[model samples]
Target: MRHQPFETWLLFDDPLTPDQARALDEHLRACETCRALGHSWRSVASLFQASPDLEPAPGFANRWKARLVQEDQGVLTARYRWQSWITLILIANGVSLLGMLLGMTFFDTFDSLTEILLVLVYRLTSLLTVINIFQNLLAILIRTIPGLLSPSGWAILALIVSSGSLLWVLSMARLARMPGRA
Candidate 1:
């Protein structure tokens, strides 16, 4: 149609206010092209209405659940498929870094690396001393734990742990029992 807005209204499903609807109707009556387009759209709408509504086959829910589980498992498996190779590459990289560090520390064949090597060894020894102190404290804690407690103390500790675990399970059960929640 020569009238552009009426042609748009005829070809597409556009919302029409009362005034716009009246103008479109007036245009359609005078324009043969717009009238033909409207008739075609109505025919298409009728065809769609005449078609039967289709439903999925039986066991749809069970089948859907099975498919979902299968896809999840497949994704999980694929995600870890390169685990060994990735781990191997990571280990190789770490070892290479460590070797490079050590080489720069002690493998200085020439005296040019001597100064840097001494500085690094001094820093490393200080770090090791701190680590050793922490390790000794942890060892002392482990050794004294049993001796610092009597049979009654052990029983009390066990009672506390059991009560806490029971409370946690009860809370989880209550949450699962709530409406609109799993």
Candidate 2:
């Protein structure tokens, strides 16, 4: 017959039947190999049962929680440190670039800028010269306008203007009185 299953008898959590125990005992008596294996297995099982279950030290959970909080604070502080440095670096670079641009515009391009400004002023002066000529001619015409008109000519112009205004008022009144006009 094959060797009895000694491992099942030794390692099972529940007690075995009487027939299985008797059969395992008979096999162990006949087979020295199986008997030695069972004895070693029993010793291992007894050692495991004798040892205590794993557990944390006292206040272990509270200490771990405190460590986690410290670690989080460290990470946040590092992140903010880098953020502040980046912002300061960007602002410094921007200010330096603006300063350099102003220096270049005023120092290196000063002569060319002055020439361009002089050209603009010359063009504006020429334009103002033409405007002054037109203004003088308009003044001369305004001064001669009264001399060009006689007393009878002024009277005739006033009469015509009065008649035209009266005609416009009568037309507006007639339109306002018309049906569907309101």
RMSD of each: 11.8, 22.0
Provide the TM-score for each candidate, comma-separated: 0.42, 0.38
Clashing pairs in 2: none
Each prediction's whole-model lDDT (CA): 0.89, 0.87
Candidate 2 residue lDDT tens string, 47-153: 99999989998999999999999999899899999999999999999999999999887676547777878878999999999999999999999999889889999
Give per-residue CA lDDT, model 1, range 1-182, as digits (tens). 37788878777776889998999899888988888888989999999999999999999999999999999889878877778779999999999999999887665654656776787899999999999999999999999998988989999999999999999999999999999773
Point to the candidate with the largest lDDT: 1
TM-score of 1: 0.42
- The weakest ten consecutive residues by lDDT in model 1 span 105-114
Model 1 residue 99 lDDT score? 93
